[model samples]
Structures are given as C-alpha cells and as structure tokens.
Target: MKRSHIPPLLDRKWLAPLLITSSLSLLLFLSFSLINAKFPPPASGFSGGGSSSELPRLPRLAYLITGTKDDGARVKRLLQAVYHPRNYYLIHLDLEAPEGERLELARYVKSEGVVREFGNVMVIGDADLVTAQGPTMIASTLHAIAVLLKRAKDWDWFINLSASDYPLVPQDDLLHIFSYLPRDLNFLEHSGDLGYKEVERARPIIIDPGLYHLKKSGVFYAKERRSLPASFKLFMGSAWVVLTKPFLEFCVWGWDNLPRTLLMYYTNFLSSPEGYFHTVVCNHKDYQNTTINHDLRYSRWDNPPKQHPITLTMEHLDDMVRSGAPFARKFEKDDPVLNRIDKELLMRLDGRFTPGAWCMGSSRAGKDPCLVSGSPIVVKPTLSSRRLEKLIANLLDPETFRGKQCK
Candidate 1:
C-alpha cells in the first residue's frame, strides 16, 4: 500500500532544466579562467623582473677594446658594432698611437648621441707601448681590465677584443643566450700540450724593452736558456679571451699570490699575452675547473700555421656562420666581409650602433633606431641566438665539459 508509483523523474521537463543549470556553471568557470589568463599575479622578485618563472637575470659584459697606431678608426667602428647600454667599454690606444688619434676617438665617443646618453663608453688617456710580440701587450690588457673594474661595478663578464676583432652576431643575440649560462664559467681556450712552444717559448729567456722604455721596441732573446716552471703547469692558446669578473678581479687585486707570482714569471717571457692568464687560471684550484676550453672566436690558420692568423674574408662567411662563435678575429681594417656582417648579421647602420629592443626611437629613412634609448634590460634576440644556444649546449654537455676543462 505504501508503494504508490512516484512517476520516474526521467521526464523531458526535468532534462531541460538540468541542462540549463549545467551550462550556466560552465560559462561562469570559463569567464573566471579567462580573467586570470588576462591578468596574472605579479612576480615575487624586484620591480621589472623578467618573468615569474624564475628566469635568470641578464648579465652585463665589460669590454676591453685595445688598439695601436693607425687603429683609431677601427676601434671606433668595433665599438659601434658591439655597443650595448648595459655593458661597459674601455677602449685603449696604446702609447704607440698619437695623442691626436686618441683625442679623435674620445671626440667620437663624446659626439655620439647614444653613447653620450648612456655614458657607458670610455677612452684611456694614458697609454703604453703594447708590442704584439712582447709582454707589454699583457700589461696593456691588465691595465684596461683594472680601469674597467674601477669604472664599472655591475658587469658580470670581461671580454678582450682587439681592433682587428669583429662581432659575428648582434649584442642582443649574444647576451640573450648568455643569460642562461652559469655566471662562474670562464671561456678561455687553453691546453697543457705546448707542442712547439716547449722548444721555442718555454726554454727561451727574453727581455722586453717596452716594459721599461717609453719608446716602442721589440723583445730580444738572451744567450742563456731557462728551465720550465716546476711549481705550476704551463698552458697556452689563443690570446683572445672571455673571462668572468670574479676571476679577473682575483687576478687584478692579487689577494692570492698565484696571480702575482705568475705575473712576475711571465714578465720576461716572450708573447706573455698568450700564456699569462692561461697559466694563472689553470694553476689555481678554484678557477681550473671553471675553464670552458673554448674562446668562442672564429679564426683561420694557414697550413702549418704562421705567427699571425690569416685575415678573414667573404670566403669564410659560410664556415663562420656554421661555427656559431660570437666573434671572429684578424679581420683587415674595413674589410668587405665586415660590411656584409653589418648589413646582415648585426643590422647596423654605417655610423650608428647596432639596433636592439632597447632602441625605442623611430627607424625612419636615414635615421638611427638607437638614437633614443629605452630600458637597458630589454633585449630582442634574433634567429642567430638559436645558433649560439646550440654552441653553448655542446660546450656544456656533461660528457664533454669536464674533459675539456683545464686540460
């Protein structure tokens, strides 16, 4: 008697109301999701932090661009090629260059509207005779580094380039890829195997006149030979280098005696620039493992090699692009290849800085985009960054990294 047929509630009337209720709930959920997508929460870091995902802070580079007599114009050109507001540049024209030329370069830096606005570029007033084959080159390089450290406080890496060196990619492209790298890594191409240097360099005792003389001169070989260093192993390679600020500071300040001792040892050594930093970094326990063993520079050598690398030209363009290095060296002044690099790779105007995301000014005809500057942290990387990323990945491979370090 109690089982009266409560009609089954699976009726069309009930179905319509149930579907409408479900649809409203779905719409409300979608609206809420879209609103959060449009305006995400603020990042936990300081103002203008890159992303909330903990992306690494962009690193700044300290550049030492050195030149000799007749290099004034080339140095100026190289400055524009690699100029970035976030980085610091210390340009040196060794004592060999005339005062007029150095003044001209200073005038050029002062006259550039962008350079003046950022105030990141400087020219060394007092110079020394940097003999290419003597220890004086090393002294000049160290002087430039000390100047950079004193003038700028926030740079992370120090790069040494000559007037002959040229950039293979845009500064933005290079900096964007470097942002992901470890700050402690030092890029120096070095080796324990001395090869011909064992007989030619290690055993020789030479005296560099430029070290003591105001006038430019060459190093002379002495009558007696000397023994190889017993304390620290010798390493030598390309004179060009990209080093970390901490490592350079360690070198310049010499809180540790190794840097000073090595400096004294290399004083009489021929071509000390090739071996000073290499030996110092390799011998030290802390910096030995940080060596990347790659200079990240593209250079050409003749068969059996000569004292100097062959000048790069258009013929080397394809190989250079494939090498994925950030810079290439031994380019002749005003070479045709440099023009092509400016036009294609760096997107630089004839007399202007290479344009990047920080350049907020108009790019109208005959006008420079970098004339009006923007935030220094903003970077617009190009496809070349992918190439640099690949190069870094190969360098950092676990199987290969340890094997290449300090060996």
Candidate 2:
C-alpha cells in the first residue's frame, strides 16, 4: 500500500513537536509520582474504621539522663520511673563513674524485657567527663543531643535530666498533655538580667580540664576576666531544660554562626549549662519567641540558694505535688520519699514500670501489667494529666506566655 508522504520540513516539524510533547508528559508524570511517593494520601483511620481527624498523634520525647560516680542505682531507678514504650532514653554515666557501673547499667538495660523489645533505650559506652559548674557539662549535653539526632528521627523534644531527678507524673500523662501543645514551643527558664552572674559567672574565665584530660578534675579560673559580650546578651537560668527538637537541631548543626559563637563564648563561662542554652535560645530571633521561661522541675533551694538544691524528702512531697512539676531533683539515693512517690504518685511497685494504657497484661497476683505491651499510641490519662494541663494552661496564658518569654 502506498502511504502519502509529507514534505521533509513538515515531517521534521511534526516529529519534533511529538517528541517534545512526549518528554514533557513523561517529566510531569515522574514529578507527580515522586511527590506521591514522598507524601501518600492521609489514612482514613489509625486502626478501626473511623475519622483520623478525631485522633491526635502523641509527641515523642528524647531524654538524656546523666549521672556521675555512684549514681548507677539512681539512674536505673529514674529510668524505670520514666520509661515508656514510645519515648527514647539515652543514659550516660560520666567518666567519674567506674567502668563496672557503666557495664552494669548497660547490662541492666539490655536485660530488661520491655526495654529490649522496644529498643528505645541506649547507654553511652564512652562517657564524657562533666565537671560541676563547667563547660564540660554543656559539652556532654551537646554530645548527647548530637547522638540522639543521629540515632532517632521522630522525637519531638529533648529533655535533659540527671540521676538525682525523679518523675512526678507518668509518661502517658505527659505525652497526653503535651500532644495538645504547639510543637514549636520550648520550655526553659531564661532571664536576660544576669545580676550576680555578671560578676561571678560571666567575667570569670575558667578552664575545664575535662575537655582535655580523661580524668575528672575541678575547673580552674584563668584569673583574668573578659568583658561582657556586646554581640549577644547573656542569659542564665536552671540547668534542667525541656527544649524542642528544631531548636536543638539549630544549636547542633548551627546553620547560622550564632550557636557556635555563643558556644565558644560560653566555653569559659562558669556553670555554662545554666546559661549556654538560655543565651543561645534567647539571642536568636527565630527561637527567642518560642521560649516559655520555665524549667518544669521542682526544687527547694536554701535561703540565698546554694550550689545545689536541698535534698527532696517526705517533708517536701506535698509541696512537690502542689508545684505540679513533672520532675524534682537532688533526691538521695533510695530515699524513702521515692518509695512513697512510687506507691502513691506513680502507682508503681518495686522493680516495676509505671503502668499506663499501653500495659495489657492483668495485674492478678500483683503482676506487672506493663510486662505485656500493647500499642504505645493508646494513651489513657489520669487525674495527674489534669494537673499538668492546668499548669500548661497557666504557662500558655496570653498575659504570661509572651510576657515572660526570653526576658
């Protein structure tokens, strides 16, 4: 059959347009496919057939619980008190702690059935030397943050605690209450007014030997003082902090030079942990407004406050509960008050996890219900959640929330 032949110019023009159209179509299809692959259609429900909009996803907390010599037992107890199937825990015992203690803690964490199953808990094998009121403490915290960012991909917040600290509320209660919060808010006690710290902390140049030497040693003053930094103002507050993951990523990766600049400036500052994060968070424009001016910890300091808070005891239990703080500090190892807290506040027994909705097993014969685990997303908050909610409401009040930020 003789087919009609078009002119060469007409054929070229038609073939070019056809090729161009095919390429454009392919490029668009590939782009749309990639977009869909990255972000799939929202699910109708998480489990049963229901609207997913009704269910709020709980936020995950990444905790860096640190301790020093003879703190292994306290660390273990604190881990048990705060342990949850959904949250991630990184336990670090400082260089002052014996190798045996670190190994013991690692063994204990590996041995736990629930912890082993969830694989959310980690122990730092190579520990840092954290000097009291020194830059090494800040360094250790930054190290932990870096490790957490590298290891976990979904945590919403970073909470730094110590072995001396104990939780007053269960993880489920905390997760339930925090799920309602704006993810960008950062809870930290910060103040730009550095009265005594200007003299005792800011001006003084102390060298933390822990940054160099492997052995633990006291930080020594340089004798010469440096003037206050004009580039950025100094802020100081409690060492305990609960910070958003985005803010921490900024601090760790430091797309801008502000974080690294402040970090270097704070290297010689006394009690850098108290001021480093405060200063960093308050000075940066992007994060300054996110500050919530609270540490979320309860501690009773002596009149004119000492280097550390007074050891919490039975006498302070009522006050602690009234404070509505999630955690409290400076508790003596194996204190009787802790036992009372376990029995009453946490509803936990000896050598058992604090029970929550995720716990599925029966409590028959005083069995640990958490021994059998269920879906961690299921949260059943208690009366304690109400208390925490009230506290958060007060903190987020329009009059107080913005007024106290970065001030």
Candidate 3:
C-alpha cells in the first residue's frame, strides 16, 4: 500500500521514454557539473585553450617606451608598432609633459580592447623628472624597469626605447627570433674607448638638478671632475638595448655591489643610457658572454657628427632595409619615407601599425588591418626577419662573438 502505483522506473526494460528521460536527466546533470569545473581566468597566464593553452609558453618582453612633453603621440605610435598580446609594456611620460597628455596616453592604452584584455600594458601613474643630459634619464629608465618587474614576472627581456625611436620590424619578428636565443643574451652595442666622448662624458661631474627639484632643468656641472673608474672598466655604446630580464633584475635590485658602484660612477656621467648598460654587461662575469655587440638598430650619425643622429629620409630607405635592423630612429614626424617603408617593406599602408601575420582584418582603402586581431602567438617571419636572423647568426659566430666582447 505504501508503494501504490509507484512507477517501476528501473524495471521498465525497453521503455524508450523512460530511458530517454533518465538519459536526459543524466546528461543535464553532467552538463551542469561541467559548468562548475571552470577555473577563473588563470592565476598564471598559461592555459588549455589549444596550442595557446598548452605548455609553459615561450616568454614575454617588458618594454619601457619613454618620452617627454609632446611625445605622447609618438609613444602611442611606437606602442602600436610593437604591440603583441604576449608582451608587457610600460609607457612613461616624464614630468615635462602636461598632465593632460599623460592622462590621455593612459586612457588610450587602457581603452584599447586588445590591451585591456591582455592586461599586459601599463602606464606609469607617477611620472619622474628627467633633465637634458642628466642622470635622471637613467633614473627614469630604472624606475620603469622596477615598475615592470613589480607588475609582471612573465617577461624574458627588457627593452628600453624613446618615442623618437620607431620599430623597423613587427613585435612578432623580434619575438620569434628572440624566442630561439639564450635567455641570458643581451643585445647591446658597446665600445671600450669612449673616443673623444671620454673628456666630455666620462670626466665630467655634472649634477642633475632635476634629481631633486621638481621642475625640469639641464645638468649642472660641479666645480670638480671625477677620475676614471678603477673598480670596473667603462664600456660605452648605444643607449637603446634589448636586455635580458636577469641582467635588469641584477641591475635594479643589484644584490651585488657592481651595479651600485656603476650607478655612482654614472651618476655624473653624461649620456648614462649609453654607458650604464654597456658597463653593467661587460663588468658582470655572469652576463659578459651574452653581449651581441650590435645595437639592432639603423642609425645614421651626421657626417660631421652632431648632438643628435641624422634624421632619416627617403634617401636612407634602401640602406635601412638592408641594414637588417629591427628598428630605426629619429625620423621627422610623418615623413614620406615612413610611408614608403609601410608600403614596400612592412606591407603596411598609411600611418597605422605595420600589420603582421597576427593581423586578420581587411585592408581596403588605407585602413588599419590590425584593428581585427588574430592569434597572438602566431609569428610569420618576413624576409626582413630572416635577414635579421642571418645578421644575428653572423654576429654570434664563435669567431665573431668571443672576439668582439668589450672591444
């Protein structure tokens, strides 16, 4: 009586409806269970989506693209040219810029859907003061590196650049080549002599007033000059570099005193960007073998030499492409040669970012194809990247690499 008219659910043999209901219920239960199994976006960036989800993944780069007052636009352009979802970036606008420009730069970077989703792009909330030819130039760069280290440890290398600098290759071109290189390798151009620069840059004991006072100002030379460093030999070269993350960590945290000592030496040294990294790499035994000796950039110094590099124009286009450099610098804004580079070399058109294999959008009528993004990890190396590869291969030759160290 207690079981009156109870449906014999398990007893029904060929009961399609009953079996269907049971199977459907089971399926629903399993479906709901599967929904609960998802982990949050991931504590670490690695995932299981596909090739993208598998493995530890190659690595990321932390970039410090710094500039002064009116350079926000150039900084933005540089960010676009070098943007890769896999990389981390920190754009810093120095105290020289109006607060409004810095705010706009931050807003633009954060607002870009790609950047916001990746969560790898950062703009310095607090800006620093850097005076002309002052140690503050080096300080500003260090500050950005510290911020990057604190923000993300996923990076492999640290590249320092200014807005005046523009990429000659896509980020993928650089990253693909870099992925194969030893993690300890640092791309820096150095010279042991320092040339006539010895008297002007090395011996001067200049104080960067901007180091203390908030307002931007030029370096103020003290009455006295300092002698050449005895503890470490001074090696000077190009200011821009692609530095290994380990070296940067060593430089910034500086567990050893070599970096700290060099910091003091360059405190009064002119053009510290050129000397700081050069000295750090050559003096550090652990990293001395990692130097590439070439800056990976195409720069044309004036025939007679000037305070700045010669501005590249159409005349330099063929030379720039053939140089096998990943970047070139000091172009006049919106120069025609840049457009030519976009068309002939980069396959990019207009002022938009140089589209790479990662760009999947349409390119009809002078549009930005990178607006539509695709696989962030896919790298389609160009003849240009291959050319660069050859150059790098030659530079890393046993005969070449060892012989060129700190020479």
Where does model 2 exceed 4 Å of error?
A: 1-51
**Window of ten residues with lowest summed lDDT in model 3:** 15-24
Where's the lowest-lDDT run of ten residues in candidate 1? 10-19
TM-scores for all candidates?
Answer: 0.87, 0.87, 0.83
Clashing pairs in 2: none
lDDT of 1: 0.78
Question: Rank by lDDT, descending?
Answer: 2, 1, 3
> Quick one: how many clashes does candidate 2 have?
0
Q: How many residue pairs clash in each candidate?
A: 0, 0, 1
The models' CA-based lDDT, in order, is 0.78, 0.79, 0.71
Q: For candidate 2, lDDT tens digit of each residue in 313-339? A: 999999999888898997988999999
Error (Å) of candidate 1 at residue 236 is 0.5
lDDT of 1 by residue, 72-128 (tens): 999989999999887888888888899899889888877777677777887777776
